[model samples]
Target: MIKDSPNPPEHLFAVRPNLDTETLLVNASQDLASISDIAVHLAFEVDGAQRNVALGICRMLEGVQLLVNKALDEAYPAT
Candidate 1:
């Protein structure tokens, strides 16, 4: 007998269940900011329609970043 598939890796990239809301929101905000920066840079590197598409993605990411930052602020307000 043989197995059809091997076991999955033990160190898969996944959110830890024990993370608190503030930590999660902070991580999410950082990730969104990084993605937006990438999209902006790629927009400048491309031409025509592709550039437009990248810019559109950047805009959407910016909206999401705003939401995430707001949530983070609300979850952990400064003194």
Candidate 2:
């Protein structure tokens, strides 16, 4: 009878790059831009204000909104 041969152990992983921070941050933003926010995705699809891409957009929009608000306020001040 032939002797049973032992199987080799599988490789294990310990340390790995920040898949989220490094990949997600950059990718998430790109993904958000090319495609609509409504599209399905693996990463967390939070609101713009809550997300980096959305937050970035919000910042720019906020500036424009502020200017408009300011102009409107100046044109028609409260009596």
RMSD to the true structure for each prediction, in A, is 3.4, 17.5
Q: Give the Cα-based TM-score of candidate 2 against the true structure.
A: 0.36
Candidate 2 per-residue lDDT, tens place, 1-79, comes to: 9865597436555434665443433444455444433322312467554566655665555555565555545655668
- Highest TM-score among the candidates is held by which one? 1
lDDT of each: 0.90, 0.50
- Top candidate, metric lDDT: 1
For candidate 2, the C-alpha RMSD (Å) to the true structure equals: 17.5
Steric collisions counted per model: 0, 1
> Model 1: which residue pairs collide?
none
Poorest 10 consecutive residues by lDDT, candidate 1: 3-12
Whole-model alpha-carbon lDDT for candidate 2: 0.50
